[model samples]
Target: MKSGDMFEAEPGSANRQEINPLLKLALELGPLMIFFFANARGERIAAAFPFLQDLGGPLFLATAAFMVATAIALAVSWVMTRKLPIMPLVSGAVVLVFGGLTLWLQDETFIKVKPTIVNGLFAAILLGGLLFGRSLLAYVFDSAFRLTAEGWKKLTLAWGVFFVFLAILNEIIWRNFSTDFWVAFKVWGIMPITFIFTLAMVPIITRHNLGDDSPQDP
Candidate 1:
């Protein structure tokens, strides 16, 4: 495994079989959906089944459910694809850690701050790699694109700074807003922003595309 060799699995190998992008997106999103739904239905479900309520506040129960759902979703993804996504794996670890703190300390702050911490970690790793003259985003994205090295480098830097911005935004939201508001924002707010930002990258991706290997230009 060379430092710059980002492809963990060779194409067409058992581990590198092309994953349906939608399914991949679902895996990424399933847990957050569970969290949001669980929170929305928390009081009702807790009333119907009181034991679930004792888990703590609606957010706490939701955090616990989110953790369980994240684990289940990851397991199913492994069962279906037999390959783990590196970035999500990193996020999952943070979920467990911060989620545990939320439960153990019986406070919502840890869970509320989890995204900021994880995003910061991502920003640090990606930017630090750039400073070292390496582009690590190539690993997680290799399954999706085949950009020229320069393209990978530039996109990597862009994502790195973008992640830092997201971290700052998370901090601002959680610090100033209510727990309910923050959770709502975490689930609903980030997705569209991320989608729009990703779309904004299309031009850059087009410019650096590997021609026939690139996504069909619109």
Candidate 2:
């Protein structure tokens, strides 16, 4: 249940190192806040630092900052824990690729659809893991909490389906809305929705809890 056990404690182990929950939350959300801020003020930023103009428009500049922020977040996580968290690693990879394409092509669409791609990939991975009897969510959630095999399976299924729904929702939002609106939604809307969804899972977690109760990494 303690933050210190986040990375160090295994299900059966007692020893743990201090890892601040606030720091962990900051690392996860910092890059996203950077992205939102950059996009909101991208024009002024480009004007102040003309070199950023080379990256293209506001969206392109924002994409560049996002890529850098994601890299820094990942690096900090590695330095702190000596191992990359699986979900963030995967999300960061998608950010770099899609961010690269957005900058390179001077197109905002790539950046907009990055969420769709990432969520869709997660959906596929979780579902595929089920087909293979792997329960891969265990790898991501294991250090945070322990669950029965049935609990893991049900949780994985729920998350996989939720991811698919998010993917579809993202596609709908981006394809039908303005760039600014989409940016706002990505930063303000999606994050809160995901948080609420995670909170909603507490009862499910409690139903199949296995006693370990370290905080989950989002």
Candidate 3:
């Protein structure tokens, strides 16, 4: 199957609802924010909920909250759009699985390595698509912008490498750092780094843009 088929919404659907960019951002970030908050205030939350203390500690509590929040986010997306975006769907699946394992095993390691698995999977899919001469990244961004085939290939390669970098970074941090520090980095550090990386790609997007009135190059 094509990488786009795995990670992007189906192409050329007449009834597909377009999500507002701001709302999309909120949906994507909301679960992570909840996870961070739950971790930071685990004691207070457990005091209120009481039963959550059985889950073990802050990371475990955060994992449970993260799983619930992720489910809610995905459900809301499906209700609004009648379809789930593939990337988020994949990530959410990981969250649920790892989160469940963390809770059941009473081991924080499962949840801690979740990002590494997700990012590595994404990198593999993107790079593997290129091996088969498909620029699957185009499908993911086609709604937002248009770029030449060459541009898509370049962008895809950049993103694939970035994902690998993220996976490695996650491994390094979670393995070496305190759970609190790791959680903080996952929430604050990664998001800003991703945002900055996106901004840095502006030149590539502009250079490769298929303009509003211009046809794609043959």
List of clashing residue pairs for candidate 2: none
Q: For model 3, how does the per-residue alpha-carbon lDDT over 40-113 read when each residue is reduced to its tens digit? A: 99999999999889988888888888999899988888778767787788899999998999999998999989
Instruction: List TM-scores for all candidates, in order.
Output: 0.88, 0.85, 0.90
Query: How displaced is residue 181 in candidate 2, in Å?
Result: 0.4
- C-alpha-based local distance difference test score of model 3: 0.84
lDDT of 2 by residue, 1-218 (tens): 45443443432334433346788788888988999999999999999999888888778888899999999998888778765666778899999999998887888888999999999999999999899986778766665667887788888988999999999999999999999999999989998999999998888888987774543331
RMSD of candidate 1 to the truth, in angstroms, is 4.1
Q: Whole-model lDDT for model 2 versus the true structure?
A: 0.82
Winner on lDDT (2 vs 3): 3
Model 3 TM-score is 0.90
Worst 10 residues of 3 by lDDT: 4-13
Which regions of candidate 2 are displaced past 4 Å?
1-19, 213-218
Error of 2 at 103 (Å): 0.8
Best by TM-score, which number? 3
